[model samples]
Target: MELKKPSDNCFTEVDGFGVAICNYAGDQNHLAILYKNPQKPDDVKLFHVNSYKSDLLTPVESHYLWVDIDWLPPIRKIAITANLKNIIDNNKDTKIRYGFSFNLGCFDPVTGKINNFYDSADGFTCATFVLEVLKSLGVELVDWNSWPVASPEDINFKQYILSQLESYSVKYPDIVTEEFLLGQKNKINDPRFKPQEVIAATKCKEASTYNSIQKPAQLVHEEVLSYSN
Candidate 1:
């Protein structure tokens, strides 16, 4: 995979599916899948699972850290893109919730079914959503079995999420419902797949050889600096 800048004409230069990583404030990041529209080959789009809302598959205008999977053959790329479009079409009306878990939830493209840790609703964090999509495409970005159990920091993050949800529920009572809060609370202890870890995994030549992310925040900072340079 090759990371390209906004000025690199990545949309036209690459003719296949890619991954986009966007860094945000508070050391947060987001992951999404990028692909060209089959009907309009020149139009590139992005698909991602977001928190507090349903999943989105929309066109790209914002610049992100575009990682082009240039290693794939043209035929394979076409097939993957088609499969992704089908997945999107099938789940167009499905309300996919946002939740976290240590386990990378399962996504079955054939049946258009999703199984997450909570098992209450179709849930996935932005990172896991992107990972599952790539997994469906026969691309394993990280070794699922290699991830360690939840740590103290992981637990703390879970608490943070709970608190944030509580605050949001109070502030936006209509949007953040009791059911949504319960679903998120159910998987609070599950191991998390951070966005930086996903970004690091993409750098690995093979998913099996990738072990773990030592410091996610530091890696994210470095990536941002590298992109800026």
Candidate 2:
């Protein structure tokens, strides 16, 4: 089930929230958002967690996806599940949930650009958009730092999402590697890994910020890890 390690995050204080997962193989792949509810985390409302494993492969496409909150019915909310379902056999079995409370802000209703979201220091809040919609909806701004923990095994859905994304991230380059790209060698062949997307989606970006400060793995923000060195 591509469930490598769990992410240490707590996205929601309420019952249901959102999430995203991606898996890639060769030149093909898939990504999706998981609408998770506390009532039935295993029987998730949307895509299931183990869905990534059905498409057996020696090597697969590892991609990024996110779980962010969105305004729904002006009171209710939904997730803006952004991902590529590159496989044909996406299982409906286990739908892993996320603890991150951040929601997606539309740049153009289809792009994952950070044109609007903002971050606060209150801790454990959702990803931010410039607008005060959530506040208007009665969601108090939380300290962003209280989101991500180190290892997912300590947390429930946080570990699940992180481990899954790590699994996919590890495989993404194999299918879309330099050798594979040199064949076509086009802009689209540039499979830039979005560690930030994984982090942002899981609400672990802020935690990484603290982690990097503690370890200083490199001297820059997490752009494309391949692009970093």
Candidate 3:
């Protein structure tokens, strides 16, 4: 599906899955899943596993370039939504902490099984979460092997995340446990897939190499806009 600005009927016009791409903190590009509400067919909502509180589902608003998965069949789309609902229901009390995983490719959506690294982190970045959900439905958005391994920058980012986790645990011990911190430490050198890589993948027909260094959000945003034109 091509990325384009949402029309006035952006919500009511669509009936299935899509991706909402927008900038966060005026710096990085972020992604969230857009799906038609099963109860209210005309309404759409955003489902994402963000670093903020684990509010997985919410109404769709704001200015975002909506990438609707127009190729999927209607029945499959409904199933995907149902699956997500079930996941939310099951994890109602448990908070899915926000963290990145290099082992996303190893996740088994059918069994809801994740690698030890992901299980320890207890969360996902918004982009990985969206990709994981899509992967559950047999939708592979990017070539996992073509992507570069983790770089020194990524390693430093891991250290930053560890510090954040330490602070979070001190403030909210009940939420961020010792086990969680250990999990975050397990995959220190793992390669991470950035939000821009996902955006660029949408425009590529075959496996393409991606730069190890992260690109500016605006550049990626403009590239996506150019694709729609």
TM-scores, all candidates, are 0.79, 0.24, 0.75
lDDT pick, better of 1 and 2: 1
Model 2 deviation from the true structure expressed as Cα RMSD, one decimal place: 15.6
The 0-to-1 C-alpha lDDT of every candidate, in the order given, reads 0.68, 0.29, 0.64
Q: Is candidate 2 or 3 superior in TM-score?
A: 3
Where model 1 places Cα greater than 4 Å from the true spot, the runs are 102-106, 111-118, 170-180, 203-205, 208-221, 225-229
lDDT of 2 by residue, 1-229 (tens): 0111123333232124344333333222233333344344443332322232232111211233334543323224423111111111232231212213233332222332223342211111112221112232333333334335334332433444445544554678543334422322221222222223332323332223333332232211222232212
The full ranking of all candidates by TM-score, starting with the best, is: 1, 3, 2
In the range 1-229, model 1's lDDT, one tens digit per residue, is: 2456667665645466777777665566777887766877787777887665665777675557777666676798888888877777676766655666434446575765554433543367788888887887777877787766567887787778778877987998776677777866776656677776786676555773225454543566567556644
Over 170-220, each residue of candidate 3 has an lDDT whose tens digit, in order, gives 999878889877877876766676676665554443433554323543366
Model 1, position 190: C-alpha lDDT score: 61
Best candidate, lDDT? 1
